[model samples]
Structure formats: C-alpha cells, structure tokens
Target: MKRAWSPGAVYVEFSSDPRDWPSVGVALLVLVGMGAALVLSFLVFDERRFGCMSGIEIGKTLVQVALRQLAQLASKNDEQLHREREELALQWSAELKAAVPQAVAYLESRVDDLDARIAELSSDPQLRRVYTNFNFEAHREAIDERRRMLAHAAAGLINPEITVERKARVERTLRALDPADILMLHGANLVPGRMRGESLLGTPSGGDDNPGRMRADLLLGTPSGDVLASSGCVRMQVSGGGAGQGVWTEVFITQLGLDVLTALRTYTQNRKLSFVVPGREYKETDRTEEAARKILAALPGLGDLVSWSTRRSSQVERLYDRPRPTRGFAVLRFRMCQWQDWKLRLENLIPIYDKAEVNLVVSAEVQARSRDAKREVFVAQFNGPHDLLRYPADDCEALWT
Candidate 1:
C-alpha cells in the first residue's frame, strides 16, 4: 500500500505484513537513543541542582564512617589499655607474691645470723664477764626489790591468822628463794653424836630373827622435829686420833634440821657435809663347791659317778670322761639358798653339754658374806638327759667355806 502525507497532517499506512513495518534494528536504535538522551538530560539537571547537596551528604556520611572507625579504634585502644593494665597488675602481683616469701626468708635468715653472731660474741669470757657485770649493776635494784618481796611473803607465811591458801602461796614463793635465806629466817638446832659399836643382833637363819641392824643415838635437848642422818661412816680428820681410831660419828637430825643446817652451812660458806642416812650393810659368802656336792648327793645314782671335790676343774673333766652314746643336754642351776625354811627359786643357770667344752671353763663368782651370815647358802641343782646321769643332784654349801 502507498500512503500520501501532508506537511501539517500525519499520514498513516496499515499493513498486516511485517515487511511493511520499519526495521526492528532501526526502531530499537531510535528508542535506545531517546532513552539515553532522556537519561543524559536528567543526569545533567541533577548535577546542576543537587550536586553540592549530594557532595555535602557524601561528606557527612564519610565523616560518620570516620567517626565510627575512630570510635572503634578508641574502644579498641581503651580495651587494649585496660588489658595491658590488667596484665601489668597481674605481673606486679605475681612479682610481689614471688618476692614476699623470699624477702621474709631472707629477713629470717638475717635475724638468725644476727642472733648467732650475738651468741658467738657473748661466748667470749671477757664479753661474758662484762655482760654479767652490766646485768648485775643494771638489775641490782630489781633484785633488791624481789628480795624484799620474798622476805615479806616469807614473814607473812608464818602469820598464824593467814589463810591456808595464802600461806601456801607464800610458802611456794619462799621455796623459790635461796634455801640459805629460808634457813636463816628460821632457827635450827644442831646435835652431835658418835657411833659406839655394831653387833650381830640376830640371824635370819632362825625363825623370827631380824635381818639387819641400825644403830642410832637419841638426840637430847633438841626440839622434837624431823630426823636427818649422815650417809655411811664419816671419818673425822681431827687431831689426837690414830689412823684406825679416827673419830667416826653419824649425826641424826630431823629433816627440817637437815635443811636448816645445810642452808646455814652454805650461807656461811662451810665445807661440804654429809646429810644423808647410812645404808644397810650386806655381807655374802661363796659356797659353790658345797652346793655342787649337795646336789650330787641328792641325785639317785650320781653319788658314785660324781664325787665332791674342792676343785671345779676336776669335776668338769670327770663329766666329759663318760661315754656319750647320744647327744645329751646338761644344765647346772646355782642359787642362793637361805638357811630359813623359805627357799627361793634359782634363775639364769650356766648351760653345759658334752659337745660344748668351752662352757666348762666358765665359773660363777660367789659372795663371801651376806647381810645375814647364818642364813644364805649357795645351792646347786642339776638337770640333764636321763642317759647322761642316773641320778639328779641337789646340794647346798656355805659360801664362806
């Protein structure tokens, strides 16, 4: 179809065929050009009108971003600083913890060293004397005051009206004082006596007999008080006495008397004097051979085989001479038998056997005297295998004999 167009009027042509239409490429190009132009225009207008405002907003946004970054950096810095502070504090605490014990130990060691040095210095005789003199001079008043107090307490202790509890306390205080001081406060009487002689009063071998003797003289013109006696026999080295006939006496006094005399003597700077009681005397005798004989006599069939001999070596040799068919055990039990009816069991026997020849040389020492001369006797008993000895030996002998 052909279409005519006027200058002022538009002419239109309709066709159902696509070939009659404009090229799609050209139409698209035109439309793209129009859209591009429109966009370009709008961009130009926008650039002219709001370009500064947009720049201001961008600047504001940049400022806000910078501020946030700065704030974050500041927060990080603060956190880092806090962490560093914490670390420093922890480090300091650790250092202190580590150093404190060392310091204390060092101080203690120093103190100990100082004390040791002081002690070493004090050990010198000259230093010790100086210290003693200084101490005596410095504490003289204090010592005097203490002595006065002690004296007051001691005087109060003797007061009859004082309470028992108070007196007890005072007495304790007085005890703490020098014993010489106490003795000087209270007067004491001294009585002297001599030991005349000693006798064998009774024998323990007989019934109802006394076993020991005590010789003491009665004190005269002295207060009724405690008794004190000297220990052992005191030999007085005085003139006009022979060597064997030297004056020997035991002074018996009350216990209080002893204390008072001891205190006075010490206060007066007297020589050492014995103030204890004499111990009982004991005498013993050996009766080994006699006991062996008695024991051999008591045995049933041993009377002929074992003979009593004064020498122990012969008896021991005789025991070994017998034929030892079988291994036999032999025991010799020795004991002290009292003459009185009372018999005490023996302990600790010397073991002897046919195989043990060394034990034959061993001998027991016997006492020569006993406290009771008539009563105590050494007894011996034998125990062995039945094949060794036909009879058991039970015998006794006087230790002195």
Candidate 2:
C-alpha cells in the first residue's frame, strides 16, 4: 500500500498482489471505524463543533462583530447630535447680536433725555431738596419703570406743587390704574364740580342707542364705581332723600387724581405722534378743515363722491357747563354716495388706520332704508382713547352686570 498527502484530503492506493490483501483489509476496517466515530460525534455534539471554529469559538466571533457594529452606530449618532446642537447655538447667537444695536440705541437716547431734564432741574435749590429728600429706591420698588419715569418727569419739569409724599401716592395710584382709567380721571378733571356718574361712565341716552353694548369689567370688582373710583383717584358720592326715594350718584376727581392726570398728560403730550391733533379747542371751520386734511392724508386720492363734515360732539350737550360750552370735542363724519364703495373703502382703510396709529377714535356706520338702499359713513373723532360719552344708568349697568 502507498499513501500520498494533499492540502484538503489524504489519498491511499493498494496493490492488487496477494501479499497486499491483508493490509488492504486492515485499512478498510480502520476507515469504517473512523466513519462510525464521526457519526457518533455529530449525534453527541452541535453541528458547529465540526466547523473551522468550534461552537464556542464561532459564538465568540459573532458577539465581537455585533459589539463592533453597535459601537460604530453609537459613535455616528453622538457625532450627529453634536453637530445639530452646534448649529442651533450659532443661529441664536446671530439673532441676539443683530438685536443688540437697536436696544443699545434706545437706551442711550433715553439716558440723554433724562440727563438734559436733570440738568435743567438741578438749577433750582427747592427742586434739588425735593430730589435729595425723595426715597427713589423705595418708590422704584412700588411702581413700574415706565410710570416711575413719567411721574419723576412731571414732578421735576411740570408741577412744582407735587410734594414728595404726593409723588409717592400718585406713583402708586398710577401703577394700580390702566390707561383707560387714567383717561376717566382726565375727563373728570375737565369739569369743576361734581358731575353725574352716568355722564361719563354710563351708556348714551337715545332711542337708537345700544343698551346691550359690551363693557369691560372694572378691575376693582365693586358695582358702584369705576377703576378710577376704586383706586381713590375719584370720589363717588350717592345721595338719597330716604330709603324709598330715588338715588343719584356723582363723581369728582381728587387732588391725587389731578396729579395722576397731569403726569400722564405731561408725559404723553411731549411724546405725541406726528398725526395726532393737539388737545385744544378749535374754531368750527378750523376743526372741520384740520380733521378733513388728516383723514385725506391717511386715505389719499379720494374722489368728490366721498364728502366729509365736522360736527360738535353730542357729549357737548351734556358735558358742557350751562349757557356756554366750556369744553368739547369734534367728530368728523365722512359720507360716501354709494354703499358698496363705502364698504370697500372701509375694509381697506381699517388696517391702514390702525397701522398709522393716528390716536383718533375711528368707527363705521350704516344708514339704510333697506338692503338695496343704504348709506355708509366712516367716522373719525379725537376723543382721546376712551369713550368719554355719558350713557344712561340702565346702559351703564348693562356693561358690568
């Protein structure tokens, strides 16, 4: 018998001579025993046992590959998250940098204004004493910055009569009240004596008046007085002959109220917008012409079909002192010949009017006999920001109740 070897298998050749017969039989028996042993190993162990790597070795190799892949995936995710975070940080930083210049400019301008005002007031010894004696930090804690600035400006520049204690009280009250409530005090300050509470705070008295018109609730939840009355800026007095008699109420601005009104007016008038009409009485024709010019400027290129006229405020009838009209406002009424044209103009003008910030009371009204026959009017009046018109008791009650 001869044997030879290759890379994958072993080969054996047996001679056909009688002398090699015994050796061939021994070799055949040996090969059969080896095959039976291989079958027994397969039945006893897993199939992976016979592979290039054993069962345990193959499992270890697969686990190492899986771990390597998992580590690579986690690293990629971490890298992506880091890049996203960096991008957002850069974006916010750019926005903050862009806004910085405008903010700095505004602050510098305000500082310059205060410096000039202080320099002007520093000349007076009495004003110096008032400032030196004032508890600025305590007052600052009591009021917001905007109101504190106005109060200080008024006390220093406009009204020398405002005592330090009065300043403190006024600032506190101004902080407590809203712009509308302050305007209410201004309306009260216009009159000398006590006026009917309903005159300014209630609904208008007329056959076509809307008694159900919604009114905002006073911050001070009391039923009898407005926010001004609640804040001690105005005194509300109710009088009755007896329990069975009809009761009437009157309101008057207090000294504290006057200070608040003065401070607001002084500050606001100084910073009034360009288009706003100054708060002063105008002759009938002058008022009409000025209001017409303002309306035309805001809505340019209007044809002759749109006509405008100025009329005395209806409130003058009730608000004025007897015999002569002491104080009143003008209402500018615009009439359009065609209702469709009026609506189109009104819709286009509403946003424009608001954007202009003209500080005028703007409204639209429709006068119609039928849907087919109608007239539209766009009205603009300088009545401050609040409705100064006096209304009936029932209408006034309808607001809060």
Candidate 2 local lDDT, 42-114, one digit each (tens): 5545465546676566545545555586699999999998886666445434433443343333223323354
Q: How close is candidate 2 to the true structure, as a TM-score?
A: 0.29
| lDDT tens readout by residue for model 1, 266-378 | 22222222232122111154234455445445433234223332123222211211112343334343343331221221122233322342222223333434676754444
Worst 10 residues of 1 by lDDT: 206-215
lDDT of each: 0.34, 0.43
**Error at 134, model 1, angstroms:** 45
Stretches > 4 Å off in candidate 2? 1-158, 191-226, 242-245, 268-401
Reference-based TM-score of each model:
0.16, 0.29
Best by lDDT: 2
Q: Report per-prediction Cα RMSD to one decimal.
A: 45.1, 28.9
Off by over 4 Å in 1: 1-53, 112-401
